[model samples]
Target: MSDARAQAPETEIVDRNLTLEIARITERAAIAAAGWRGKGDEMRADQAAVEAMHDALTRIDFKGKVVIGEMRGSEKLGLDEEVGTGRGPDIDVAVDPLEGVTGCAKDLPDALSVLAFAERGGLLHVPDAYMEKIAIGPGYPEGIVDLDKSPRENIETLAKAKGVPITEIVACVLDRPRHASLLAELREIGVAVKLLPDGDIAAVIHAANSDDTGIDIYMGSGGAPEGVLAAVAMRCIGGQMQGRLILDTAAKREQAERIGIPDLKAKYSAEDMAHGDVLFAATGVTKGSLLNGVKILPRKIVTSSVVMRSWSKTTRWITAEHQR
Candidate 1:
């Protein structure tokens, strides 16, 4: 099929404007983060990106609000103050100023600055708990597998259903101590496993767009903020994703209850979490698995990103040029 015919029709132009603004924010954050690469100061790098984004957001004339954001308390010294409230189009904001802090510190690939915008009360305000997640590229049947199954079993099932070998399926998981057993199981099953230090948003996007990236699935627990951001991108790309909250402690469970997450174990689909119109964008800060790090040239800097909206199933690979 022609790309145009396969693409979802663009319905709302307003989202395009929002996307442009978000792209600008991410671009600026990427530039600001470039200076902190290899400094062994992840917090400083993230703060610089956050400050740049805060400044860029203030310039935009949207009365949007933030439903999910970084923690604000004594722990953060120079974090941006909350500027959004429950007003205007009832929007929700999810941002990761620098998605891959360690990757940026090591100058690895796939260190991205990410953001997701949805209509008010759209994206789920999930707690900071582990989530058993399963995601695939677009046009796959829903409910093909569940997180309860063994990693090998799920891989075999998906391979049989998709009529491909288990070796062809690329699964991404964070390179953490918790993933050691899971990685071994995937290796035993002949599936290619991509271990990333951070930035599951890029991994999720890779799974949601199989035509460009060969990644067929993403299965693991990541940050709650990243789950929401990934859902926004999957919503735009017509992919399937399901996440169930995993709370490890009573304090975290209470925190979830406080945020009104009724069932911590409830399976949340992409739409269930990020409903209504959505605009998602991410620009690379340091090179990792999905994208390259921002490059500085004599005249300008170049960055790559993937932007999408629910109204359009096609994902745009944008290369932005910024003046030095």
Candidate 2:
């Protein structure tokens, strides 16, 4: 009799292996970045994370390309930098080695090392800019919230969907002058707001896990690269997100056009940015909303991570102890 399990396709096995391997990639970056916590040198902490992540990536067994990454002018792991052992499935990699360098430097919260991978061309090739984003977690009416809707309207609609009052709905936004109007509008509607200094990716994921995070929605503009990473996480968490690029200048528009983005005002949904089977991994550099920061002990380092696969709808929280 033929063994049914043996007949499974090679790509399936590759994907499963890739999911586990990607977690380790984020883990290495997190551990390395944790070493520089509270050093008050954001550049040095970020560089450490980038170098550690790049080296770990090169050791993975696959043909991986950095489609979305740090700026090209960077000294290490810039855009289009190829990693891996130069073998296995071809994949597109989106990475943010240190999502909150300032937070890490000051020993604040919500710093992380994050990355997303998909089969070649599965991830969006978005140029680094700003993205006007709005997101909500799983289990709601289709289109309960939207990027085109007003802040007040989305809050009202979400409240109605969740059987709660508008004032009880909590929204998360970055604490910045640019979001002053956004915060004012949400507050006007009596929506509770949680403002963080940085880490939009973690904020979006929190909004997606409302039951655990107590954050019902996330809105406002953030980095385009981080937007893609958040989209991938939402895909795994069964959430919804919409983003429109904030290409305000000619140079930014030109950069988008050069990247084959003909539509300047193109709106990208979570799935649109990270379509098909995908894997998302993140490890906290500092205590955070979603995962705990790396805890360095005398004999070993403890790291917390989350690895998710959209195809399988699998999300794993890994607690690993590594000997120093």
Candidate 3:
């Protein structure tokens, strides 16, 4: 099939205007979360972001369906919710209104408001669960890293492919108890490991642009929705990523089935998760490795956002100053 037919019935669904509109959506969520920064209340901060994002989404000129969203039952953007104005082509949307609630509450780095857009049935219907992910930046061999490979073996292969020593490669992993063994293994292999408090989406995106972000690889399990979001960005940037959902409970397995996932042990590649002309947008809610934090002044709010399109291979950095 041709690229256009594989992606959508109409080629104009994800034009530049729609890309910028998605950035605005993320910007609103970032500004709202920025207000709640350092308040030590994660719930309130997340609520602010969700409300702001949903409001912004409702104004967009498209028919959007939320395939992946908040896992918690109380969040505003629920799974399967229909957003957007009733005046545009039908599309799929996956969102994380507030990706790092803990980071926002504690004023830590790497909190972000993120979302991805694709034509209907273009994005994987990933259920809310833990996902094991490993990613690398662009320009590497297609199978340089694999989820089935041990961390030591993956790093050794990546270092050889990059023409760098094992000691020079920097791996990014989430700072959680579950990663204790993973971190230790990386360190034992003489690979430098950077631990992040929250936000694996930023970590993986950093890995996608190691020259700028200083992250050569990202490994560990995080929210499955964020994994899908990261896959979207990786697709736009010409990177590699693989993920496998951990359906440890019967309920989780049942949930995956409801979302149309047939195989409980299925592994996902970047293209498998988000295929054919994807648009991804993210705004930094706090100071982070990938993006700058939102700046609020007396009368204006400044936000840094990155918008990407896979078909055009276009990555645009936008700084918008909004008058309050």
Instruction: Please give each candidate's TM-score.
Output: 0.89, 0.95, 0.95
Clashing residue pairs in all predictions, respectively, total 6, 0, 0
Kindly report which residue pairs in candidate 3 clash with one another.
Answer: none
The C-alpha stretches of model 1 lying farther than 4 A from their native spots are 1-16, 72-88
Query: Residue 239 lDDT in model 1?
Result: 75
Clashing pairs in 2: none
Q: Residue 283 error for model 1, in Å?
A: 0.5
Worst 10 residues of 2 by lDDT: 4-13
Clashing pairs in 1: 90-120, 108-287, 109-287, 109-288, 110-287, 110-288
- Candidate achieving higher lDDT, 1 or 2: 2
Please report, in order, the local distance difference test score of every candidate based on alpha carbons: 0.77, 0.89, 0.90
What is the per-residue lDDT of model 1 for residues 155-225, given as tens digits with 9 covering 90 to 100? 88889888998898888788889888889889988899877777788888888767677788898888876
lDDT of 2 by residue, 1-324 (tens): 257545745454265489889999999999999999999998878888898999999998888889988753456677888888987788889999999888999999899999889888888888779999999999998888888889998999999999999989999999889999999898888999999888899999999899998999999999999999999999988988999999999999999999998789988999889997788999999998788999999999999999987766788999999999
Give the alpha carbon lDDT tens digit for every residue of 1-324 in model 3. 677647764355555368888999999999999999999999989988889999998988888899887765555678889999877888899989899999999999999999899988889887778999999998888898999999989999999999999999999999999999998899998998889999988998889899997889999999888989999999999889999999999999998998789888988999999997789999999988778999999999999999998877789999899998
For candidate 2, give the lDDT: 0.89
Error of 3 at 312 (Å): 0.7
